[model samples]
Target: MTRPSLLAAIAIASLSTITTGAFAADQLVVASFGGAYTASQSKAFIEPYMAEKGAKVLTADYNGGLAELRSQVQSGNGAWDVIDLELQDALRACDDGLIEKIDASQLAPAADGTAAADDFLPGTLMDCGVGTIMWSNIIAYDKTKFQNGGPKTIADFFDLEKFPGKRGLSNKPNVNLEWALMADGVPNDKIYETLATEEGLNRAFAKLDTIKKDAVFWGAHAQAPQLLADGEVVMTAAANGRIYDAISKEHKPFEIVWDGQIWNLDVWAISKASKNKDAALDFVKFSTTGPRLADVTKYISYGPVRKSSQGLVPEAIRTNLPTYETNFKTSLANDLEFWADHQDEINQRWATWMAK
Candidate 1:
């Protein structure tokens, strides 16, 4: 071949390589609850998904609220492509048309070939969100505070006379209302039923009033553990994962109380305004599947949403998981639908109650 023709051919080849590399390395942003939870997600899902899809997964952190997402959607400026949020937030976002409706058929099936619909634990799959983990709101106490034995039940948490310490609770109404009713002798099965009525609502608030004077309210998941550790409060209602990190990583004197634990699902959803919708969908599908979901447990104790993923979790950590045999038996599922319907009313009431 002529020298000029050979030089042109070399230029064409180099251009092709550069274009192909650019297409192969797509990037997406995932917003999640930060700290140890985000770290676990990066290791278990983001890194592996990047390796497989030849994409970059940028991580952002939030305090588990939909305000930022709503702002982006309203302003038409999409910053995050995907988010890890609680089930109730996902439902609200979907209703407000801030998030994309997910096609469950696109989710990866179980290892045994079960369809995604049949494989995901009940209530985990939703209209807009795909649940990734089965986590719980648990009561964690400092072992040093309870020398003989720690508070065991939800009632004990509210009973200052029995447990006898300043308690720490999240500064939200979601799980606190349920815990109050449960502690007030409302049966586990009837928690939502009681919460749904005026009488039930009054009962819960009355119960909360018992401890309101002595309780220390925490605004973040990380703060709950810190409160217990710094001797600010002897006991706190914590996300099971945060307490797990406290005991396992920070070497704090903490033990989780399984009784009255409110189990809930943490889900992933795509923003409707996301420019990278296709890439975000691909990332979500890859992460919530069999091995990937279960792999998160190695870093944190939350159970995988997929039933098939349970077997992949090591037996040693099984007891710590929200789905563990003992823990599962006593826990109540967080009713996201109910919360979705009444969140505004409850929040207003909670604010008023807190102020008084």
Candidate 2:
């Protein structure tokens, strides 16, 4: 009630308002498929996302992104605020009721996500998750091992006589199975179709057996570049970004054969239970916007999901990625939908085959 006490109270109130205002400007938590993407998000997505909304951003892991959502929904105790889900996981999330339908009205009618306006990536922006980063499954090899410099087609991956060395592969069956079938002379376009048949599965296993002794099945992303750098394996099928990191940083004599590269994406989705759903959605919107996307794309080596940001990225960083333009003459686009349906069956066969 005294004048000095009143003055002190006013000063305290002013300081609280300033602090809260600054904090409110930008602050959101995102669980994304981590690794290079996380670092890139900090540069391309998070920092800018924060600046745009006047909020500070935090990042976490949810590889394949929606796995955490699936686990949370199954356990009935969700923790993530927002996630960078993969397409298959996004589909599963919807079926499992882990995600709330995105409120389209929250976004501008002309916002990049509005498909009727033809702004979003092909078939990515419905009520499901949005694509944020895109990369490819590429054939990376040590140039020093081959006289002709290496094989071009997927079949060459099986030609141990011509390009003899230990090999590496992703532990997952989704992409590697296609490479297996391709090495067995299955057409790239018919890869998933053939794999659906028992004969195709047999042939893939047969091809895998040829290199089983020399193969190092990589269960983690970091293992590929490390295996490549330390000479643990001579050549392998690897994600383009991981190989890029190895060669780009250490100047490792490596190259990617894009002949049968598989395009992959990381999708962003909001948790159904997130009290900060609106704030999370705002974070997604801000992260995918032009300025932040371009900045992040440079270091991450993943292509921007938003078409608007493509022009903003520097030419050097832009050329390193597999863009739609680079995909023109090459074979790409694996059957993600098919994998979603048969991952369990294929994974079983993969385990059996690897055991042999």
Computed on alpha carbons, the lDDT of every model, listed in order, comes to 0.83, 0.67
TM-score of each candidate structure, all chains considered together: 0.90, 0.83
Candidate 2: C-alpha RMSD after superposition:
12.7
Instruction: List candidate 1 stretches off by more than 4 Å.
Output: 1-24
The alpha-carbon deviation from the true structure for residue 131 of candidate 2, after best TM-score superposition, in angstroms, is 1.3
Question: To one decimal, what is the Cα RMSD in angstroms of model 1 from the true structure?
Answer: 12.4
For residue 218, model 1's alpha carbon misses the true position, in angstroms, by 1.4
TM-score of 1: 0.90
Tell me the tens digit of each residue's lDDT in model 1 across 248-315.
98899899999988877788989977877878887888898989998999999998978888888889
